[model samples]
Target chain A: MAHVGGPVRAWRDYTDGAPPPMLQAALDCFVEHGYHGTKIRTVAARVGLSVPGLYHHYPSKHALLVSIVQFAMRDLLDRCESALAEAGPAVEDRFRLLIECLVLFHAHRSDLAFIAASEIRSLEGEARSEHIAARDRQQRMVDEIIDAGVAVGAFGTEYPHEASLAIVTMCTGVAQWYRLDGALTPEELAVRYDTLARRALA
Target chain B: MAHVGGPVRAWRDYTDGAPPPMLQAALDCFVEHGYHGTKIRTVAARVGLSVPGLYHHYPSKHALLVSIVQFAMRDLLDRCESALAEAGPAVEDRFRLLIECLVLFHAHRSDLAFIAASEIRSLEGEARSEHIAARDRQQRMVDEIIDAGVAVGAFGTEYPHEASLAIVTMCTGVAQWYRLDGALTPEELAVRYDTLARRALA
Candidate 1:
């Protein structure tokens, strides 16, 4: 079940590419003002573009949100896959690697992580389902790895499904409270989370 | 460290009282439209009152948000105290009971929990600080329990602070994904989380 490479291959790598200025402006607006509170006009003004000019790129406010969320997810998935590739076939190693990747992603990209977690409600229809599916995929990955660990006695949790959910939830929560200026760097936080994740399954 | 009667005595008990209709209407609007997206007029319309009539009861949209968030936190804190009171003197028992209470609250009161978690950013000035202080109090309770457990050698986790956070994060996350119609009742979900919480500290 621990396939080396699959869906992660399909995601475009935006790891190094900063969001275009317009998208960043929209994201900042959405962050400061909830998605519903933010106006396309506000995004346009922030980006120093006309409404039409902003629309020329993003089409709509909803489109900008989708782009931002997707960008965050893709970069995360890309990092996850790369980490897993180097983790080899040991389930414990893969588990630790996955958690580290998640903690780092949530902490290092706290704003994007916060938006992705908070604004899922604002997404509608197919976009909502698509976003949920993508999120479920991430959860499923965690579940599978945990399940495999249990299968091989590499992990000891009886409730693999719940453990996976809890681990992912806590990791996602790093976005909620993690401050870049805080005592722990993202790497230190990742190490701390790695230990906690293991204890939850150990 | 586990002082029982201090803060709990000072907090008003709203555990059995549902929020008033106007506040409920405001909460519904805030939940549907992010705090930024909701209007006082909309909440007024939902409750069949004129704008000034609504303002007479609740001064502004911000006031509504603050009231709703405070309601959620007070109820949670009240319940946490009651649970802790009955949990006896053992650190592990208190730990289990606290997690159970959190899991149950987030699952049963998913809407309030969701708003409390998601809309904290929408709060401003003193309201934001007050809300956060209340929240940190809850975390500190967990931290104190974990630290006590660590001191007694009942909990093996070296990273007590991180473990406390991870446990609370996972419990709060129940609000995001829990559905009443889902397979698990709140009690059942609470048991699952209780096990995971112990595993994290074991």
Candidate 2:
């Protein structure tokens, strides 16, 4: 299912822009502890800083989470756009590339992906709205690809909208279970996901 | 497709063997405030009890989370077994029944399902191990069905294990997005998913 010709970038490339060391440590804490469960003090402590020092960097734990989520979402969006642009002229090729990118992102950056997937409930107001907006944009990317494919009679599913959401959700879920010591590399997993997704779309 | 035969129970029917009302109340708090985020006092207040009274029922927050996860997993397992039995002799029928049962469980008991999927990280020792065992058993049921279908030339996928995990994850994720006011009924959603999953398995 992989693209056979031209330069194709993997989804693992997107997470290169990571948070700062302090924020990264804080994100790890947030992933292990629910956002509500994490304390600024604990996050600071993890990075060898006192509570007051941590406060200097992040006004609150909430700020840290907001930054982490926005970063992950934006990074993913930016990468998807780039990858899709270079995914050749075929709609099927573009769709497969999107799946590969999504699967790779979820597998490679499981922590950030986990926070994005599971902790949205802890966000509030503009933060929550912004995250949802980003998420919707991501869903739209998949939906549009399906539409493009359907336009060319390349794919058919009765539940187009629901199928879009299902495909996105299925790929995002790789973060929940993909393991470092497991059998497949991130690339291999992405290939398999792309294949399975093709089955769904076919 | 809901079973048209004798009474086909919803997956939530299994969770009907609910915890005590107080523990149930505590579960709501845990779902919102999270395992580390929730205090015994909050659970008690939600149920009109003192912290000491809450402690009288369940020793700690950890206990509450463990109870909730185990209950949800066991309940899902029991219902799936019953559903598969009545799903008849055809592998395709059995596969469709699994998706219906899974979609119904996730939609009806979303909170419990969410807690089970996202909070395993909060559990420790035997609780975590037992919950994972139950989850694995659920995955194995899905896998065995796929294997049966493949044996009969009813289904085909090169990555059987990965496809099984993907399908289970995809179905379980309905809990995260399925809303009571959404476009589809639980039954409607189940049929759509069974259709989509059949595409993947094809």
Candidate 3:
């Protein structure tokens, strides 16, 4: 299968490795102006590509938006899964790893952070449902960690699901105010948030 | 002072009364389809009034949006202050009260939550600055409570400000997903969140 001008390839297959720059430009524009407010022309201009050239890469503006979100979600989930596997079987370590992933995830992909926090609702039909399911799965992973900790007497919680939600929300909220140029590095923020989560769950 | 329709009553005063059926209609519209997307005529029609009648109560659509945010912010801050006073000088009690107020605030004024989270940036110049200051002041109150807790050794944290920000973000994030018809009441959610905060700081 030749990776030519196809919707799936334009969105998913970056084997040729040219789509990342376009996606990066789109992410920045979308974060600043919102999905509905952003225009393909602006993204193209930012990337130094003609509008038609941009369309050669992405069939439509919505396609670009969806691809950005889909790629970011997949990337985040993949990182968390790996972190969980590498952190081994301890529930506390797993939770800490997840929190750390969240902090670094937000730091590296602030554009995705903005979209995940603000633009998910704008997605429609299957895309919307898939995004919601992905988000719920992420939430459920946190819930499972908390529940396991509670079950084994490693973590104490009055309500595991609510506690999990609060923890995740607190960590994800870092994306709103965190600055790469600011005082703390993503690693430091992760450590701080991990401490906060441990204390919250303790 | 007569509470009837007149310029003698500021926008703040009108919010104290019934909130006019039209304003409620407008809020619903604004929340459903953002501030920029809502039409004045639609708001009027929802409340069974002429557009001019809607304009009579609010000078313009921009004023109406600002009024909604201002009213919600004032109400939330007032509740926080009242809770603080009623809870007295104890750090733990103040923290608990603040969380309780936050849960209830998010539950009651979900439209305001949507607007504050998504639309405040639309306001320009003095209006925007005023809203930001009010938001910062609310945050500072939370910080003060956390600092007091740290000072008294009621809370275990070297970074009181960061802990306070995390707690506030966690609580506010509830509004994004909370439903009145959900399994947990606002008070129940508050208790759950309060426990999480205590643990995180512990």
Candidate 4:
């Protein structure tokens, strides 16, 4: 299922840019205690700031969450677009690259991705809608690839939309269980996932 | 991919046993505000009890969460075992039934499943180990089936463990997105997933 002709980029090389100091602290606290369990004070304390000082930057706990979510989504989408551009025109190749991108991001950025997945409920109003829209955009990338693959007989799955969703969900879920100390590297896991995904489509 | 010899059970018919009043209220609060955000007093208030009164049945907020998680895991494992037993001896049949059972459990008991998946971090001590063990038991069910299928040449995937994890992850993820009011019913989604899973194995 891997692209045979070209050099596959190292999965570790693609990353959701490192979060700033405050957001990194917030991510740590949120991952440890969850969104609701985390306190603005704790986040402030982590960064050696008073509550009022932290407020000068993020304004609210929700704002901190919004900033983190936006960063995660933008970084993921940017990587997906770049992977596609680098993957050339074959739909199958594009599909493999997208899967690798998703699996690697979820595995490498597990904490940030975990907060994004588990804390969607904490986001409200405009943040919630924008987050959902960003998620939908990610879904659409895989959807279009599968649709194109099927159109050209490169993939044979009858339910392209649901197949795309299943593929994305499985990939996104790498955040929930993947461990850096575990048996597989992000690169190996990405290969395993891409192979399984391509076989499913076949 | 669906079984053809006998009447396939309705996805709606298999259900997690409902929680009584207090646990249900706790589940609601946890789902809405999260485990950390929900107060013991608020759960007591929802059930018309004082803090001590609610504590009579469950000692702490963590206890309530453990109860819910235990219930969710027990119910899911029981359903999966039953689905496999009813599926007879065919590896393909067992695989399809297991996928349906997982999809149905996640879609029908989404709140309970969501809490179980998201709040594993909140579980402490023995409860955490027990929850992990039960989850491994669920994973093992799929793992063994895929292993058997691969051993018998009924499924062609080279990576059985990885494939099973991908299948289970995608199916379990239904809890995050499936809705009662959505375009597809649980049964329809189950069939679609079964088709996708089977094709992936093929």
TM-score sort, best first: 2, 4, 1, 3
- Please provide, for model 2 over A1-202, each residue's C-alpha lDDT reduced to its tens digit, 9 standing for 90 to 100: 3544333543445435677788799888877888888878888888999999988888888888898998899878977886788787798889988898898888878899888877888888999999999999999999998988888888887678888888888999888889977999888988888888887987
Clashes of each: 0, 0, 4, 1
What lDDT tens digits, residue by residue, belong to model 3 across residues A140-175?
889889999999999877788888888888878887
Model 3 misplaced regions, further than 4 Å: A1-19, A49-53, B1-22, B37-60
True contacts kept of each: 0.71, 0.70, 0.57, 0.83
Listed in order, the DockQ scores are 0.67, 0.73, 0.48, 0.77
Which portions of model 4 miss their true places by more than 4 Å? A1-16, B1-16
Docking class of 3: acceptable
- The iRMS of model 4 comes to 1.0
C-alpha lDDT of residue B88 in model 1: 80
Per-residue accuracy of model 4 over B1-202 as CA lDDT, tens digit each: 3544433443336433587899999999999889999999999999999999999999999999999999889888887887888889999999998998999888889899889988998999999999999999999999999999999999988778778888999999888888889988888999999988887777
Per-residue lDDT, model 4, residue A3, is: 39
Candidates' interface RMSDs, in order?
1.2, 1.2, 1.8, 1.0
Model 1 chain B worst lDDT window (10 residues): B7-16
Task: Write the residue-wise lDDT of candidate 2 on B71-160 in tens digits.
Answer: 788778878887888788899988988888899888888888888888888999999999999998999999999999999999888888
Pairs clashing within candidate 3 = A199-B199, A199-B200, A200-B199, A200-B200
| lDDT (Cα atoms) of all candidates against the true structure | 0.83, 0.83, 0.77, 0.88
lDDT of 3: 0.77
